[model samples]
Target: MKKRVGLILLLFSVFLVPANPNPVVAQDGKDREYYETRGDIVWEVPTDKKVIALTFDDGPDPTYTPQIAELLKQYHARATFFVVGSRVNSFPEVARLLANEQHELANHTYTHPDMRRISPGKLAQEVAKTQETIYEVTGAKPQLFRPPGGYYSESIVNIAKRAGALVIMWSWHQDTRDWSDPGVKKIVNKVLKNARNGDIVLFHDYGGNRKQTVQALKEILPELQSRGYQFVTVSELMNHYGTKKVGQGN
Candidate 1:
């Protein structure tokens, strides 16, 4: 009886020991060398210049997306747009414009549901559907994905990964409340005050009113440009740092 009790406790102890926390695991050891050489799929930019990746979410909105794209073109800069599937359908022309203007078209889900609150099937649908629409419009599959309202879960990230996207989260951003018309100057100053190199800046395109948001970008981009910051797509910024590409697994 004593021996059995000791064995049971030892088994429990073994189970209690925590496993390593690695996001990606290579099934074959030989694959690691290749993946290591290829590098990470996505990464935060690590630089000293006042460089930042401007990313717009929930877009292809007829009202704001075209205007924003034109502003980016005028400044000779690039940005990432995480577009919604439904919006893409409603405004296919706008979708084409984003592609034509050389903006990064990324995934923002089909219906723009709060990604953290949905079932895995629903989440996967949201991600995969948007990816399909983006590819359909641009002939370029999205490499980056951002959740609606920046709310996400591990399941969301995993599903997005399976859809062949790297989860993109901004490193520096404050709630612009642009939907509320928080005044153009306030939004511009907010971005400028917290700006940094290798930082991902978040703004909205659809969802709600974005007039102030558009106005803000007009002000902020030139100021940042004058300061010598070159805006690029999210992938460009990540590659400028270092990206570790591992085998694909959900």
Candidate 2:
């Protein structure tokens, strides 16, 4: 009876635990070689020039996007907006405004699912649909793609590569964490303290009470400008760094 009870408990435990607890599916081993030869995820550019890329995610928010755009315009700075497909559809004019103002409109997926667990076909659709939406609205296909929530697997990178987008990740040092709405002072301190050349600072124009972000930028932008930093889009940062691939170093 004791052995039988122990065996039953073992069986029950097996059922409780998942085969892959982490949702991100692992790609085939051989595919790594193939993807390695292709593009890589860019964090920051590799240059000595005082240039940085400012990227905003989850927008084209009708209210905050215009304010952010106006701020960028006021600072004479450029930024990259990784927009969601559904938002672009909802606000086509705002999407057009992003492109028209010389800000880049990159893909952030259609529904913004965590790409790690999604099947390749579903992932392809997510990326392709956003690509199509952005192209239709902006007349330009984005060369950059940022995985939702910055969760990436080999499979996710493969899908973005197949769709002709280089995956973009931000430097660990520069993440503003504005999504948490940590107040304007914390957000300002985060970027201004770590400001450096080839840094890609992340911000959000949408996704919630971005008035704090707008306010933080008002302080961060001019301070950085006074310190001689030039704000450029992500692609331009990659070009400046001569980064040809995404996961090259990893």
Candidate 3:
């Protein structure tokens, strides 16, 4: 009787677990070892060095990209811009200016679609087209790619890797959300309060009126500089200081 009861309990436990294999059900990197190759997915690198990576997305905007680039210059800061392929084609001069200013140009897909919802072939095309576009305008091939909205899967990462770019995700605590047109003060406070060593802060250049971002940068740059934090591109942060094995921002 005891043996039969133990067998029945084991069978019941097996039935209780869900059979769906997608890691989206549990994103905690437990079964993610296979996908986390060579620090391909990065949220923020871990280091004691006072270096931070500021990443801007969805750009090549005629108005805002130039303005942001100027502010970065004023601060003697370097950042990575994840330029959309379509935007690069539309504003090739703006794209060139970013590369010229010593900023790193990373890929952010051609149309910024939800990678999880698209077929694997379409996702591959998005990454390939952006690489070609960035190289065409800047004469530099990007080594990093940020998926639209930070959404990813094994397939997306694999495709990006095949394109020879690691996936770059920003620090969760440092998201400024300036694309939503949040008040300039709010944007400034979010970045200032949460800025940390080896953090990758997210900002946007194209989704909307980016004046708040410009205004906040006006505040953020001077203050972070005062704190003795050096701004470096994403690649520099990873290659120079080394990356944390498991990254957040899925």
Which lDDT tens digits does candidate 3 get at residues 108-177? 9999886557788998999999999999999998988888877766677778878888888888788887
Error of 2 at 26 (Å): 7.5
Model 1 global lDDT (CA atoms, 0 to 1): 0.74
Report, for every candidate in turn, its global Cα lDDT versus the true structure: 0.74, 0.83, 0.86
Question: Candidate 1's residue-wise lDDT over 38-147, tens digit each?
Answer: 33223256677566788888888998888898899899999988888888888999999988988888888889885436788988887888888888877988877777
Per-residue alpha-carbon lDDT of model 2 for 200-240, expressed as tens digits? Answer: 88999888889999999999999999999899998777765
| Candidate 2 weakest lDDT stretch, 10 residues | 18-27
lDDT (C-alpha) at residue 39 in model 1: 38
- Candidate 2 stretches with Cα past 4 Å from truth are 1-39, 243-250
Highest lDDT: give the candidate number: 3
Give all TM-scores, in the order shown: 0.78, 0.83, 0.84
Name every residue pair that clashes in candidate 2: 39-246, 40-245, 40-246, 40-247, 41-246, 41-247
lDDT of 2: 0.83
Where model 3 places Cα greater than 4 Å from the true spot, the runs are: 1-38, 243-250
Number of clashes in model 1?
6
Error of 2 at 145 (Å): 0.5
Clashing residue pairs in candidate 3 (N, C-alpha, C atoms within 3 angstroms): none
